[model samples]
Target: MEHRFDLLGSGWVSVECDPKSYRLSSGNQKRALAIRQLIDSAYNPIDWQLDFKSGYRWRADRLSGTLRYGHEPAVDVKVPWELARLHHLSWLAQSGDEKSIREFRNQVLDFAAANPPGYGVNWLCTMDVAIRAANIIIAYDLFISQGIEFDEAFLGEFHALIVAHGKHIMANLEWHDVHRANHYLADIVGLLFVAAYLPCTDESNAWLIFSVEQMINEVERQFTPDGANFEASTSYHRLSAEMVVYGTALVLGLPKDKKAILGGKNSFPDWYFERLERMAEFCVHVTKPNGRVAQIGDNDSGRFFKICPSFDEAGGTFKEQHLDHRSTVAAINGLFEREDFEEFSGPDVALDTTVVSALAGGQKITSYLKPGDNPGAMGVQITGGVDSGLSVLAQTFIEPVDATVLNGLTVFSYPDFGLFIWRSSRFFMSVRCGPVGQNGNGGHAHNDQLAIELNIDGEDWIADPGTYLYTPAPNDRNAYRSVHAHAAPKIGDKEPSRLDFGLFRLENNVDARCLCFSPDGFEGRHAGYGVPLHRHIEIQDGKIRITDLISGTKSSKVIPRIVKDGTSLRKLWSLDLRFSPGYGIRD
Candidate 1:
């Protein structure tokens, strides 16, 4: 069996030797130690102890061994085990201890033996399988580089396990109709990685061809022309971008004729790299001064890997870490040699040579021309409706504005995605004024049409209520995606977009646009509640004014809502309510 060792480098540098070399963040050593203790006590570390499967339809305590893995109906056991991340293995690999490495090897072998080809919670989701495959491949490379020797039999079993995973993923591709997000992207990336590096055979060659086509199509289908993800979720955007990065690297590392044959007329590397640059720039633009991107849409805290410390370290899980935007920026910068992206660079910015080495295959990365600049900023100012104390920003301006005035303020408008950002020294705000989401009911889009998020005094004052969970508790899922959860007005209890299908699906897109933009303020309108609702936003003198006007109707009233944390619910005209600060969290 001939392996394509030429794709990825011969071996990856161990994390112990160069801690900051890879984009992956340091593992939770504490969790690893606890697992070690459990293993020493003859307890299987793979057993799901914590009940992370609460609100889902079928719940069980896998730790107590009450629920059989493959026998359980409609239960997703991935959450409980968290095996997809392979953080435990990462911790052990980082430890560099002989015993820990041995334990890691044994644990993996034990899992393969117990799970077999198609059994248990591990094989439930093909996306999870793909993730596990990629991590294992990386781990194997890392271990071999560290002088950890595996007998031929053990190596054969591991290789067979990976092939099995590749087959499973290829057999059951997770392509949601017109709603392909990170999961599907991950599936393709994992397949490509296995096909590229694993021992080359007829099966591997077939998988590679199929994955290349699908990956290219998915990139165009999922990413907006303006560079934003069609799903309209910042978290998913990062995840999908990472998939593109990894997939592109593998494809680029292929032999010249092989790449040409795989990617016919158009060059796959050039196509993917173009989008990669756009995706990276989009991340940079949306990122806040604090190095965190706006949580504008659904955030399940999913990632290809934990490449940074958990953002909510005190109470959140390892998966809940902020997407490693800095590492992504660094990777893009290093590969493309674009210095303009420096403005978005953070202190944590460090290039991960793993990706570079994989792409280069022992060759030096050649310098490329830097891409053009991203959209320049335009200033904004608020003008009207100060006395009403209503959070009213205008949407439709009746008067024509001057061109010079429009150019003064720093404003970014992604017309394709229907997102607008206006920033000044003291205040930064983003408005959602566009289609509900991509084609065929955007699975990741929230009903936040005409909704606005405000960061005043450098603090997020008004925000979009993030997606709490998917397919877990129906009520919570619906509530988080509802208009009530956003900073948008509800017209007679009608949602801008209807939840027509499952947890993530939406119907009836609200067409919204920025009708007028100037240094003074922004005006936009949306048609979702059988009437055009206009919103006008103005920023001036450390104060914001928002005005809402309903057109083509008078009897139907519009109640503008704002979501904030630690606020009183005192009623003057209507009932006041508190809102959730984040997913699975309420104040």
Candidate 2:
């Protein structure tokens, strides 16, 4: 049987080292130790305990039910690949036992044998399935090397399943959407693994080659030019990079046309590396005073894998770079005793990393937006709403595409329904929508259209804690969308009346000056592409202040005046953003 080692990715490396002899060597020892330590520390002894505890009794019963009746095979019933890999691998690794491994081997073989190939979710969980399967393959390979019996039938079945799934994704998935970036990596790598181990028949070989080419093209097009913004969360971006780089590396390792894969030496721009640096920077900056990024979008659970080596070590190899890559690289290198490593840098993250709250006595609460959309979205918390700090909107806008919505905007939410999405509109009007729901449709249905923060010096308070956990459960959505999560008082109506804030950019296209308001200091500038114009305003006690500053080609400024009854919070609450005529492109 001819095995093709060319199932992995091949790319430019500034260093020369024997891939075969590579192990956790040199300064890498620290990284290896860190990896092991993380796993060990997180692996509670109770996790390995076979007996059920009082707290997990429900979960234990549910698992028992699944073991007994869940496999009846309803067409709608889906068993995630990750769960299977976890079960089989955990059973094997935890006990060093062959019983579970052997049983799982048989089960995988039997299922593959019975089911037709390439029949699964084409859109949903595509990358997820691939990663779980690859992890399982890795576990199986490890076990077999240890003299644990390997069943040819099982191995063949697993390989065939991979090929089928690969073909399924190639034929169906929309490769254009940048949101599918991570999924593309997982699928590509999974296919490469299958090609390496399975029989390289004409059909399988062709499929493998085609999948690799398509994936490379997708990465180049989606990540390089437009760049993956990963506005969702820092952790998700890391996860995204992991799936892609890991899979790409596996494929590159396979014997193939390296030049074609890498688009020739110096053909691609260095933006990917730049993006990685930016992402790493954001991770370093946005993490709470502690080291946690807000868990907003699709973040789940995982420790950062410092031991996992990628093209990043060479610095600028790939086309889609994350911001924090530089810092993470530095931290990882420092772990391994590399002199080139950077010093640890970042604010102290809050311990809760979930939600924080404060009370004064008045009706003032403040919740800062979470860092990332997916996982980082969860990191948002509130503190001293009516009590501690005056209501403040300290925002550092990072321009990129949100991971979930795949737009150049960041979203904020009050768990279930109270939500907000903001984007820098180069056009005359600033565009925004709010207080939405999390029902897998267009962004969300949050009723809070144009929400702004205000700090009031008072004795009474109410605050909104950003989020605790995720949804379906009553409080799950509340983590991102409860009224108590923000400093603003909930209107009598369950929903706010008008929710969209529009801002038309003025034509002058110049940086607007900051105007400070007393009683409460405030400064905000409209920052980004198109026409550069902004309105900085402030409020304290019963006093209201407004500042109009817009930098444009014509250099103009409108006199500051209250447009509505400043004393009435309701009428004055509206965000009025208008642009001088001819401040934008002619329609």
Candidate 3:
């Protein structure tokens, strides 16, 4: 087969190897099975179980269709369906199922016929277009690699689709002033993928340079020196980090001779890889024993690629299921050939060794963590040795810091991001006492300042009310970002930080500081609500205690909103409220 472009040298990529070599994890296989079943049943997996073909109006959870983007009803429907179709087809193509391949090809042709360039809801948001373009490229690559050939006309249409996507993204890139969040990152990644994988042309070359420059600049601007995503949202952190990984892989996977030609002046520097490694490590540190992360601020459950299934076997939604952070870490390990990262891999998470093996040469990849000299040297501080009785899951790649390192209460402070984690044998609590969002705009940030999430005995008790929707519904959007939605104290019905006019934007940057720290407790204060509000947290044995102190304001009524699951207002002396288990779900 003659190649039009060489993404990983002049050879043709193939998946005609042993199935075991590319096998996804059991959890991912379950998700793939679900997708396969949905396809076999002639049901679209992302219709939100609603009949879009009929006149049934689509609504975001309980939010009315009359709100926000409701004017363009198809905008919400197209993105998810496009994502589901691409993922379903990609999985089947990777598996080399002939019938599925035929179906996928037919679907691709059908979609192109139905939705022309810039005509459908799928093209409404440049971000969604970018996502679809990347997914199509990946699916097409997998299909060709599996020896499935398309007619020249089909190929022409596909290439034209790519061209249309590229022009759309270049013209409508999501660069709104200083609001460079995960959306902007995804746009550039899509452009880079299109630029690299497609045949070289003047426009493609220009896009390659422009995307590489923007990506490099965004990496430095969006992330702190400590590698924390400036948005302060764990879900967005993963999204942004994956974009970095994908961009890095695209560049590094190129032939050595073509490296200079592709990279040009905006070449990735040494610090870029180092920063990426640190970002992955940050994901590792923040992950809980149950394979879930702390939903610090707003969590929309956004993802870049879904090669492996992200579902758990119990049939829960995306938010109910745990995100496999280890998969991304494994890809990074394979990309950089860093044996040090092997400690972060485990059997429970899915591993795409095909992508890894293709990008990095065939190397023995293990799912077990091995002890090394100075294991703590990988960026995070470690102090304590493993206690024999601790569960294997509780034991992290970094050695458990000595209780004394906690100074007595096991507290880890990321001062750059103003994040503090306090842990005891039976409890874990995370406090967000930092600037409200990043880059002075807080584009992806919520208005939950000095909020906290608590976990007791591996069960989330007081938790963050996850972000329900973005931009589509105005009232629900504001409700989720309200002070009453978080586990924080509000003064006279006032928010600690001010929410800006745009979606997911917050202003009046809160000035917060950790005033005191000890082995048994932490003390912090913020002045975002026109008064100094202080919180003191103490954990002794299994008992948890929290105290709030407000100063500089008299006659100011303080209403504390403590969000907990499985409790009622009748049980406690407060008003009962519903919580969003995931994005677009409130219960």
Candidate 4:
């Protein structure tokens, strides 16, 4: 309550506005209530260095490495980072909640004091460092936009925090020699925010120029012409798309003098916006009739920002948390004003979409909601928002597609991402057959080549099992990512890909290919077992038929090995499936 307002953030120009003046359409009441709930919970308080999942409190004075995983609890560092993100504070400030606003400032000062630069578990991961910085900027910007003022002492401290995060990101970027995935992208995007807000010093401007150049190069390198993220996962597509959208928005809003630093272009070129729209198009297509994505690869339920609140933190609701992909869709739809995405996501999304539109300098958005409106006929009860994009977002690689319609539902294929989706009024099908992602490293991709996620009627009956957890829970992680967890063709004692290192990365030994693809059906194969294993899925009215064949092998001699203990032969393999709504929470 006593901290200086300027002590809140580094350099904020969009000040001198009124929170009372901030307004949203009455139709967005439900979403606004969600925002209130999220902020109210913030008062439940945050322990900046506590791993809520593991109940391990990180020592503030120790080096990040000094806190070993083998320590009691083998803590999940993300637990603290989640709350420390401070995104809820923006919603609080956005709503003109003065009490929560003061608490937001107080919490930041306390967090910085506890977790100084270069020490504590929060500072260990540069990606989290950058993400924290971005969230911090958003909250600070909103506060200042309301003409909130601060003392010089508080401003100095806040500026130091921004500089610290930027220095850490620059020093420890998540760059990979072969592929700069979402982690690297998070680094630059976070740095981009720091550069824009930090009073334009030489160091800050250097960060601006460097982040801009990296973003331009990576947009083309990371995403294919089809707009699918190279990460090979639907949830990840939402994740990466969020970062690209919000980060680009900030870049676009930069002054002409600042924008000119990008060589000659004032901002990202025409192609950048085109690809971004297509990225949203991918979201538009992959969504099932149930309002969730196909869950093509991994989905750990990661997000960039949370504008709404429906996610159960303990990961209680699997369908609610893991399967839902609406908020990200809503944000992108509103930001770009895509009627197509709005058609898929529905009009009620104005709740958070309006805020995103506000961030984009108030893009004109109209309501598409009627008295009775739902994404699907019986929409899944879900409410949430994503972090900039997940998220360490997902990827896969496949040869360019030769898509054709054969008197059936239209086929939407992401050739580079290796995803083939077929959608009609009541039936939706997505076939997962493609090369490995992360340059064949398959970092965020699952071993579900030739797999399929099916939705018939309004509800999701069969789907890919989501990522249960990572690193901390290796067995669960491996179990969820295994070929058995997906609806792919089964083989006797064969796995399409190896769970290399038994962690995030996978080996690309299996060659996934799309033999023939059309709206009528799909025929594809993988070279994982001894003989070429082929799977053909035929799209029929109100139904789908799947057929598996083994080439150059006798049915008798090459029969699958006898199975017991919850698993059967290829024909009957549902016995060993696992479903998880998100990381560390299973259903």
Candidate 5:
């Protein structure tokens, strides 16, 4: 099933023009210098392909498909793709950093020349391909807006890169079954940006029509009724949300007629903005008072663009920063200027808000903003388009939730997301119970069916261990996602889900359910280990009381025990769970 785009071979780079531009601010000059300096940190120019941890280099001569994921000594394809994502280089060009700009240009030409179209591990996964191309487009568009110049030779080479990336995505789109995931969504977005930025041509226009329709349709599909991502992982929720928000803004910024396609007959419905707001609302609720989110599921620290700094003292590499979820809140706030979204908006996310403001048709954006002030206003209006089948199973309102769960604890339940949250001024807890993510493929869902992450008195107590790695080390991957990693009942060495399914999947044996959910407490059960295990959690007199109602007596050597909540404060200090919060982060 091959589709066609007019951009196939040489001379596809159309003449540059002042098509409506959403120019990103030239970020912090100091940080831009660091980014430019470290632009070459991830890849080895000698071979142009690399594995950071293992030092294994995939030669440019090899086809991406030839190098299998999780090969023996273990090579991560993400390392090279990290360099190719080109965010730092883009910023360098945007900042007018002459020295770094030269490096950026040279690197772009070298990488493109070394790894021709479909060669090397960098092009292996279409998801990465889409992300890489989108970033390159963003950089190029920004450079154009800033009046930065590039040599004719590099422009020719770069346009060829764009043509190749566009063709590769259409051919290898990750659309397979009834359930399409983030990867598919990203593919559409990449193509959308490419089509939007390219000079007016039938090929780019056709791509525009196809991608715009699909972006709206897929965003509706991938997000749950409660606004949680279908991937079942909170961090991944941020990644896919970014693709939708950023892509939507670019479409809104297009010239009137081109943008009319979104508001006319087909129209970009209101529900799209509503769900996006709720997705940001979900971010507010899941994040703890400590400012870090409860790593509810897989967090690869994935992003479409590094528009904002990771803000972590331990941050430098692409994978290091993920705990901060407020920037997403700020991005949403910037796009719609929704009053509810202002909760997480401040100095922390001023840059993020400014970036989104530019993309959403705001005026010339600056890198700074006064507190409580948004960048600029987008006069564009979104009218038309039907419901598009958007179901709001759980409603999220900006006002403080009035419902109480005994003793001032606020209860929030997103059944679609399979999470029950109870929070008070001094105590907060989240219980995981629901369908395996990715439509039960459980690609990003862990085996912690009855798992709970608790923070009492603003100190991390029990936690859901985060995803450390994928593909490269199978055992660690299984271990991190194992039921044993969380404070949930497990029967003597019996697993609730099979880890052997695949690196990215989990087959849930446990039909975990919440039988009783009320202000009193949360009572849930699961049949993951061949026996029904019940967990009753209630707060009493400010301390937590967790009871396991396992039928144990006469013939009962087999009984589910309540996993303890207290771990060493030392370990808790290590990472809120004695594990890295994201992939490639140190243990």
Candidate 6:
């Protein structure tokens, strides 16, 4: 099918922000520029140095450089540049010459159509999700503008591939189901757009729609309400919220004639808007002075915020409009107007929705180290709410860091070797001590406890971290998981002393404290001595609080507010931890 292009000048013009509503403060401008610069400087995965020893043959120097720069195409080169370039396209689409637009559309479409299998998996490191989506966006825009005949055959072929390999997509790519970041959400939206536009009969289209709806429902159910996130970072929250917006729009955009089949509204369910707002607000909660989000979970360090476009061409336009409006989501119950978005946005809070953002945010957050008496494996849950909150199930320290690590990994790890551990998203602050001591038994295989986001601004943080990189070799996989990334101890022995394992589960002013009653007496051979009460308390705000009343400890007055600046709470409680000389603790 031949593609045509429509060069509409009005729509292509740059968006204008309402000066009063979308004011760009000096600080906000600086933060935005910094974030842009960081993305510009770090948009090369070649700097990451990923190990390819197992598969591709290579010279030593090349291998060394790849290692240093994460030479892997999927993680390093492709994605970074792709994301950066795609964002540039979004920028250009608003102001480029007709010749540039035509050339850009042709090149991007050709590259996308000619990609390698697995949707260009081999070229992926060089092509981040942003790039892939951007390519789709460009193609879609070209098709829409030129009024090209929809390629029924290509759609059929794509659908046929899905029909043939639906199970593989389900099983192998299950993580996408749980992924709450922008990239995964964008993929989901793209798939939905394809499904919606495909010309198949009802019989063939039914299953696909069901599957798509299931994914959408999961996104709504898991990521909002609890105001919790796997990584507990700002950037990722932005990504997830954008995904929600994209998904909602795709659903709402279904031809009006087909609207009856869906929930039958011009927009998404009211609750979806609520959850999106909460997720957006939750990220705002963690926003800092700089426009760049505070990296909280396992935020990618090799590359930064390379601008990537959406898969659906229309989506790209929407994103561009939003970006021009500073990409802000409105407050609760507010209509998603571009002007209103600026009122909610500030340079201090650019939404970040990647693993890298999570780790970086984790470092900047000061409250992680405080003592909270709540302890135990918080019940793992994933659900949605009415107030537009995402539930992220995360357990704060319930037992000592060591014990919590042992218990959490025991339940969530690979289960076969006990050697390979995995956790839901946001497994940060890891320290491997030659694979022994706290690092040996406590960390690894996965990060610490299996914490769920209870509420993003009052909803649930869904799922855990999606496994984007996994290989047998230690270093290859370890690149994504480590102590240095997490907020835990990196010093020789700064790991927390007391084995306090209490999670501070918060929902706005309300928080549920979990504490594990050591079912059996402490029986670790390292210390040789049974310890004292294994928990303490540090509360913040007027939210109701619960403390684990260990059998022998007397009732004590615990501090209600835990400060972020490292000021000790007033006589809440203290521990006298005794570690044998050589051993260490983990945060």
- Tens-place lDDT per residue, model 3, 1-587, is 11011111111121112212322334344433432332234422222212232223333222121223444432344323333225455666766676666566555654453344444345556777787787788778778876888777567767877888899899888886766677788899889878877777778888887888899899988877667788877778877887777676766565543455564433766567667766766676666555667776676656566565455445332323424566666666655545545666554333543564464334332322245532221323323322122111100011112323222335566656657776544456677777666676766666666667666556655567667666446677777787777766566577776665676577755787776655555667777777667766665543445656666434334344342332432123232346664555565
- On lDDT, the stronger of 2 and 6 is 2
- Please give the distance, in angstroms, between residue 229's alpha carbon in candidate 6 and its true position after superposition: 3.0
After superposition on all CA atoms, what RMSD does each candidate show versus the true structure?
10.2, 19.8, 12.2, 12.7, 12.3, 18.3
lDDT score, candidate 4: 0.65
Superposed by TM-score, candidate 3 places the C-alpha of residue 84 at a distance from the truth, in angstroms, of 7.1
Give the true-structure RMSD of model 2. 19.8
What candidate 1 gets wrong by more than 4 Å, as runs, is: 1-43, 48-78, 145-148, 255-266, 269-271, 309-320, 340-409, 424-426, 540-542, 554-587
Off by over 4 Å in 5: 1-47, 260-266, 314-319, 363-407, 424-426, 551-565, 568-577
Report lDDT (Cα) of residue 280, candidate 3.
69
- The regions of model 3 sitting more than 4 angstroms off are 1-85, 256-258, 263-266, 315-324, 336-345, 353-357, 360-410, 423-426, 516-519, 553-576
**lDDT for each of the candidates?**
0.58, 0.32, 0.58, 0.65, 0.66, 0.30
Per-residue accuracy of model 5 over 356-385 as CA lDDT, tens digit each = 777767832222235674322111111222
Compute the lDDT for candidate 6: 0.30
Tens-place lDDT digits, model 1, residues 1-587: 01111101111111111111211112333323332332333423333222233322222212122335433333334354444346446546655577776666666654554444444445556777787787777666567667878766567667877888898898878887856667788899889878876655778878888888888888888887556787777777877776776666667667765565565444454445566667777777676544556676777655564333234445432223353476666555545555555455544444333444455454333333334534322232223332222333222221112222223346766666667786544445678876656575667878787777655445555556566545435676788788877777566677877876766677754776677765556778777776667777765533345667776543344454432221311121122324443334444
* lDDT per residue (tens digit) for residues 252-283 in model 4: 56665666666546556557766776777777
Worst 10 residues of 4 by lDDT: 390-399
Model 4, TM vs. native: 0.79
lDDT of 1: 0.58
Candidate 3 backbone clash number: 7
Q: Model 3 Cα displacement at 369 (Å)?
A: 15
Residue 151 miss distance in model 6 (angstroms): 13
Instruction: State in Å the error of residue 103, model 1.
Output: 3.6
* Best by the lDDT measure: 5
Q: Each prediction's TM-score against the native?
A: 0.75, 0.43, 0.75, 0.79, 0.79, 0.43
